[model samples]
Target: MKGRLFAPRLVLLHLVFLAAVVASGWLGWWQWERAHEAGGSFQNLGYALQWPLFGGFALFLWYQVVRMVNGTELHRQGESITVPSATGHSESAGEDATERTTGGARRRSPVPPPAPPVTEEEDPELAEYNRYLAELNAAARSR
Candidate 1:
């Protein structure tokens, strides 16, 4: 069976989650001690709350780690995300549409024209960069 996976972004989020868990645990520990110093009992009911809350946070973090290891996609952008394409199906049609509608693979433009013309006079800096790139390309090709 074919399966789609978001490998890189998921791994990044897992790392973030791991860091958050460590930070939360350390803060929780620090807070617990601070509470103890303020005449709070560490072995009492008040102290019991800290362990469960911290432990729950740790468990939640661990669950995310497990999901990441199992190749689950993590959506950090607050949107309903689809599985990333493992196959090149979208590379053919989607890329062309993206190029036409959004301009190139980067989507730098908010809305791209169907066919945009290059004008050196309009943007001299970009034109210069383009010329530099062309020179680099020509030199690379000659090698």
Candidate 2:
């Protein structure tokens, strides 16, 4: 863990984070000074307060990165985190794609699968239109 923290890439990251925090603090201080000056406005005071929050957020992100690198995040504690699939069912539930059970009620997709393609003989006009579009696309691509 200590070795990982001091790795070359991590060292660079640490320096960057330190620079961000320092820069934010310096900006906040500058804004605070501006707010007290004769020409200062409420906007300067707002910025003075906002800069510290940015520094605090940077600190939070840095700490989270360190924790993730150390494999100490909550998700790494052998706890299963089930994400819902696009069909609105927990992926880990092992339910069939055609149907799924949610809250003791079976649910299926309201939208049906698309119908098979229509052959040229079945719809000659549509097929001709499609061929025309394809020709136009090919012409555009050649240019």
Residue range with the least summed lDDT across 10 consecutive positions in model 2 = 72-81
Candidate 2 lDDT, tens digit per residue, 29-64? 999999999999999999999999999999999999
Name the top lDDT candidate. Answer: 2
Deviation in Å, model 1, residue 21 alpha carbon: 1.2
Considering only N, C-alpha and C atoms within 3 Å, which residue pairs clash in candidate 1? none
Predicted model with the maximum TM-score: 2
- Per-residue error (Å), model 2, residue 88: 19
| Model 1 weakest 10-residue run by lDDT | 72-81
Model 2 clashes, total count: 0
| Model 1 misplacement above 4 A | 1-6, 38-48, 51-55, 61-143
